[model samples]
Target: MYKGERMVLRFSRGQRVAHWALAVSFFVLLFSGLTLMIPSLAPLAKGGVARMIHRVFAVVFMLVPVYYALADRKGLQALITESFRYDRDDLLWLLRMPRYFFGRVKGMPPQGRLNAGEKIHHALIILTFITISLTGLVLWFGKGNLSQNEFLGMVMLHDIAMYIMVILTIGHLYFTFVYGALQGMVTGYVNEKYAALEHAKWLASIKAEKTADGKLPQSKSA
Candidate 1:
């Protein structure tokens, strides 16, 4: 940024806290789950230790929504609402996704706080989390009540949901590094150029809401 040019707030403190809480719990669950499934890692799963760890983190994973609601209800609401509310520009942005994937993002249509790809990714994450949580509950509580085939089906569904989240996380990490988006989550702010390039509509909204003293509103992201 040029000297004296202000950086824009991209995420609020509550938003970042909820995000990191989800991330840390998700990774812990993933690691413990892998130890249970992988042959070479079976030694780590012996004595039910890994199972216990998995159960503990599973509760944390399931509580992510509650944490987000308590921490930043407005941000969570915006994420859910904007993810499903696409417009003409969002469609245009989706059509130019190949360019985005290749890191050539300059010419894409202006996007809201979430671009089209992010909308799809966030939607899938929310959907997969719900499925995973439900299946996990059944596997945990219905162990004795469920028949053999029914139990197996619930386990399969749980694994599928986990696999989907794993894939989504990979893509998410790639884009974060590719676009230097980690700064936003880390500092709750982003460079003006980045805000313009990736979230012009959101930046404009912020500008429109600037107060008489030129201070920005203390609201959640988007």
Candidate 2:
């Protein structure tokens, strides 16, 4: 088994469970949603299976936000709150991040539990969920007689949203896989070195918690 010291519980068991549930649902929805996007692909006969799985997982996806809010309301609030106080240092850090990719920025900004990029990504996801849910509902069960033109408009909107989401999802997957950032979600903990380097402010919080308890908090290392 993997082991580590100076770790913190970034996500509770409930949060991790909810995250995985949503992730699985997303995969199902993505594949199923794709089948509907291309008319030529619809005639392949397996489109029905894809639609069925997508609809089932769409329902499951709804539980994610509920669980997250109930399980950790405080955390959720922190994640959503937008802070407007940005210093010149923050600007410098933002500009410098690209240098990190080229091994130029040796010591980047001491980030908080969530970095600026992560926060932006999270916000985009919230928007995506709202758009997808609303548009999907109209496609699935909207009443009132609509002209073919109106229906096509909704279909076009849904397709555009899905394509945008897919692009964002690809970026997310690249970060998680290529950069080894998925450990935070997969194991509920980040290594001390990683936390210190990437989330220094968060590491301070963990240290404070450890000091209060006189022991390190439990965490699963990837």
Candidate 3:
């Protein structure tokens, strides 16, 4: 609503903070974890530096969910709910996903707040997070107790989960830049037009929440 541009609150303050914390902690973990895995990157782990970094950020990484839950419980709930729900428009949208990949967002099927691809992405991230965390815990705490085969298996699962998340994060970044989505996360707001194009159903729902006096309803997703 500033500068005469009608803006929509795509995220809230709590959400923005949580998003940045997650992003920062994720990248740190990615690099440190890579250092531990790749022989060529072994030097980067000099004197266990990378291992220390990885372990420390793993704590931060796990704490992010708790922070998000406390800061914006309703928003977290909404996101989880939205990320699992899909409809017919989502099917049509998937068929045209290539157009979206190339930066075309217009004239596609109307989407909800989290679109279909986004839902899939979030769902995958959630699953991988669980996989990585559980395997990571076993590998960390069960070191001396676990047999060689069990240890190796846990390590394999942990690495696979990390690789999958790395791939997803790269795609996430690509789409972020292609679609210019950074602003929404930074400011918790987005242009109405953009919302209409990328999240028509969500925008309509938000707009419909407006009161008779023109005030937005009390909502974290306003």
lDDT of each residue in 1-222, candidate 3, tens digit only: 213457788888988998898889899999888886789999999998998888899999888889999999998898888778889999899999999989888868999888888998988888888999899889878969999999999999998988889999999999988888888899888877778889999888887778455876533342
TM-score ranking, high to low: 1, 3, 2
Cα RMSD (angstroms) for every candidate in the order listed:
2.8, 3.3, 2.8
lDDT of 2 by residue, 1-222 (tens): 224555667777767887798888888888777666678767643737777777789888877888888888776677667333344545666778676545443577876776665665677777877778777788778636667887778778777777777787887786666557787798787777777767787788878887999876654444
TM-score head-to-head 2 vs 3, winner: 3
Which consecutive 10 residues in model 1 have the weakest lDDT in total? 213-222
lDDT of each: 0.86, 0.72, 0.85
Clashing pairs in 2: none
Model 1 C-alpha lDDT versus the unseen true structure: 0.86
Query: Candidates ranked by lDDT, best first?
Result: 1, 3, 2
Instruction: Compute the lDDT of residue 8 as modeled in candidate 1.
Output: 83
Candidate 3: regions farther than 4 A off: 1-4, 211-213, 217-222
Clashing pairs in 1: none
- Candidate 1 wrong stretches, greater than 4 Å: 1-5, 211-214, 218-222
**Worst 10-residue lDDT window, candidate 3:** 213-222
Q: How far off is residue 149 in model 1, in Å? A: 2.2
Q: Which whole-number lDDT from 0 to 100 does residue 35 have in model 1?
A: 93
